[model samples]
Target: MNIFDLLLEADILVQISIFILLGFSILSWSVIFHRVFTLNIAHKKLKLFENEFWSGIDLASLYQKSLSRRNKLNGAEQIFYVGFKEFSKLYQMKRCSSETIISRTLDTMHTAINIELKTLEDYIPLIGTIGSISPYLGLFGTVLGIMHVFVELGKTTNNTATQIIHLQIIAPGIAESLIATAIGLFVAIPSVMAFNYLTTQINNLDQDYNNFIDEFITILYRQIFLNIDSVLNKENKHEETENKTCY
Candidate 1:
């Protein structure tokens, strides 16, 4: 039988399942493309922010600059924004002495990493669901087709008393079973690939964010505790020696 004609004979409920699977495949593909573009942008933006962060501007400056509407927020921006806000709030509250500020800042950065990862990880479950279940749903369709084929076979045996040959009995059932499995794989393969690829990219971005935060905190430690008086003393002595030598 023609594949089209077999499709025409398929039960409505089974056809609906196939349609649902197809829709899921398309949605999963769309998500894959979107995440690919977003993750690429995130990587580039992270590189940009990491460069600026290494130059040793004060945290307050980074915070304020990020808070302003001018700096475009990307994945790195979000992670920094979250950490900086918490640190600033704690500093204002006098929650830590100077000695503990760095330790507390590390905690805040950890929390920021969680928040950013969760935000990126949203919708992952749905893709996973589609991948895991689509094939079984297709199998269910095939089962229904087989059950239907058996019923028709039994009816033919009573009417003309002609034995239903195995091939005739099995033909549509075999076709439907394979078609159902094919549809399932069609939905599942791409969904699984998309899920794994997006997950890897998200992990890489998260790691980059964490590394930047760790190094950023180290930079913060030095700048905040600058001994201004020591620098002035050296400059003052240099000036005194220069004046005496001139006289």
Candidate 2:
């Protein structure tokens, strides 16, 4: 029989269970598709930004470019911009030592990473919820359907015709009830797979961000030493010129 026929014949509780499962299935699929697209974009954007960042370009130029695309800035770019801006401000102020500037910059990047993680993980729980609850929803429908069939069977008398008719009814009802379980599995398997895959991707990105932070700190340290060296060299050169003139 058609799905409409089975749905029409289902007990009220079974119908309710089926409808609820259907709703869950729709919402879970939506979350899956949305997350796929968003994460893909995030990965691509990060790769593009990383290539630019490591190309030996100046931080000021990178920061200006990032600012121009502020609305479209991805996770890595956003973190870099926030950390760089803070670093520049603190360095120029000359109020904090090099260590303090690095510490504060790391803190800013950590905060931005947390925010990016939250955005990346949005709606993930919904997929997990669907995976966990869909099977139970289907089982509930099956249990309700079985109970309904037993109740109808009990109503029939000892007449052979009545018993045979009830048996026929039971067969169709049982088949219809099992459809709920099938649908539940259909909803659950993909959700579980998607959840696992997305989780792995996010974790990788998290590690990438952390590594970048450490590498950036090292770059800042080198810049500080280079500046010190340049100043010292200028002083030595000036002193030598004066001594040579006196001699």
Ten contiguous residues with the weakest lDDT in model 1: 238-247
Residue pairs with clashing backbones, model 2:
none
Q: Deviation in angstroms for 247 in model 2? A: 50
Tens digits of lDDT, candidate 2, 135-179: 988998998888888888888999999899889968888877877
Off by over 4 Å in 2: 2-4, 159-161, 225-247
Highest lDDT against the true fold, candidate? 2
Per-model tally of clashing residue pairs: 0, 0
C-alpha lDDT of all candidate models, in order: 0.70, 0.83
Clashing pairs in 1: none
| Candidate 1: Cα lDDT at 194 | 83
Candidate 1: C-alpha RMSD to true structure equals 9.8
What are the TM-scores, per candidate, against the unseen true structure? 0.77, 0.86
Candidate 1 lDDT (Cα, whole model)?
A: 0.70
